[model samples]
Structures are given as C-alpha cells and as structure tokens.
Target: MPTAVYAGTPVTVTEEGFYLDPDQWREDMAPEIARDAGIDVLTDRHWQVIMHMRKEFAGKGTGPTVRALGRTSGVSIKELYLLFPKGPAKLAARIAGIPKPRGCI
Candidate 1:
C-alpha cells in the first residue's frame, strides 16, 4: 500500500486501490501532487490533457492511445514528447491518479 497526505488528510492505497477525497482535488494543487507521485512536471496545458484523459478513461475503462490523447489535448505528438520524456503512458497515468502501469512498477 502507498499513502499520501493532502491538506492534513491521509489518502491510503490498499489491495482494493487508492482512495482520495474529491474535495482535496484542486486543479492548482494536483500537478504538484502528481509530480510527487513520480510524474514529470506539468503545465496548465498538461493539466487540461490529463483531466481529459481521466474523463475519457472513466467513460471507457481503458487508457487512450497516444494519437487519440494528442488529438484530445490539442498537442502534437512531438510537443507531448518534449513535455513527457517518458511518454504519455507513464506521465498521463500518474497525472490521472491511476495506478502506475504494470511495466512502471
């Protein structure tokens, strides 16, 4: 299990998975927290992309392909790569608050 504290509240992850307080999820603060979780730095553009990806995954139950993600984010694949050297799969997963992908673990 992994845990992180936000605003004096503790969030814990167990075999069942992570639990976070929705109230604690402020857009301004999320990028910092995401970085602490091993993500690369995020800009406002990245936040827009990450949030969109999260919504998409919630609706579909699977992550998007890089091409789709780039289209949704309005960023080119080249731009995305410059921002996320490890690629979308790793950085986006962290920003979306999803568990690290299998290979990352």
Candidate 2:
C-alpha cells in the first residue's frame, strides 16, 4: 500500500494508486485525484459517473464495470470514453476514490 495526499489529507492507496479505503474519500479531493489519473477537469458528466459509481459501490460493495456504467450512469459508452480518456470505468473509479472496477484491465 502507498499513501497519497489530497486536499492536505493523507490517504492509503493500492500499488496502482486506487484508494485502499473508500471511506477516506472526500468529494473535495476529486479534482486532484482526477489530475493524477490524467483527467484535467471533471465536468458535470464526469461527476455523474463518479457519483453513480460511488452509489453503486455503496449498494453492491464494488464499483460498476464499463458495461454497467454505460447502461446505468445516464452517460453513453462513447461519451464515457471521451470523458475519461485514460479509461472510463478505471479512471472514473480512480477519481471517485474507489477501488478499480472489476474487469477493468
């Protein structure tokens, strides 16, 4: 595990940089996390996916996959790619401060 600082707070993260504890996540840390994940800015559309991912994680104990996000996040798969160019579900989960979505690789 590694520790990352965002918004002046230290948070534990995995070797790949995903947060180790989702409870340590704060919405205020999102922008910095997004930048670290190669997303320069978080638009409203980005937030939609982030919030939906968090909601799904809270309900299901895991982040949604790209397919699930496309189907339920109100954002199309094409647009998701456009929004998070590094990788939609992966980067979204990173910025959301949640663990990487299952099957992201």
Q: Give the TM-scores of the predictions, in the order they appear.
A: 0.63, 0.94
State each model's C-alpha RMSD to the native: 4.7, 1.7
Tens-place lDDT digits, model 1, residues 1-105: 566664455665434332333333445555665666555567777777778766766676655667777777687788777666666655665556554444411
lDDT (tens digit, per residue) of candidate 2 on 19-102: 979999999999999888777888899999999999999999889888898899999999999999857888889889899777
lDDT of 2: 0.90
- List per-prediction Cα lDDT, in the order shown: 0.60, 0.90
Clashes of each: 0, 0
Q: Enumerate residue pairs that collide in model 1.
A: none
lDDT of 1: 0.60
The true-structure Cα RMSD of candidate 2 reads 1.7
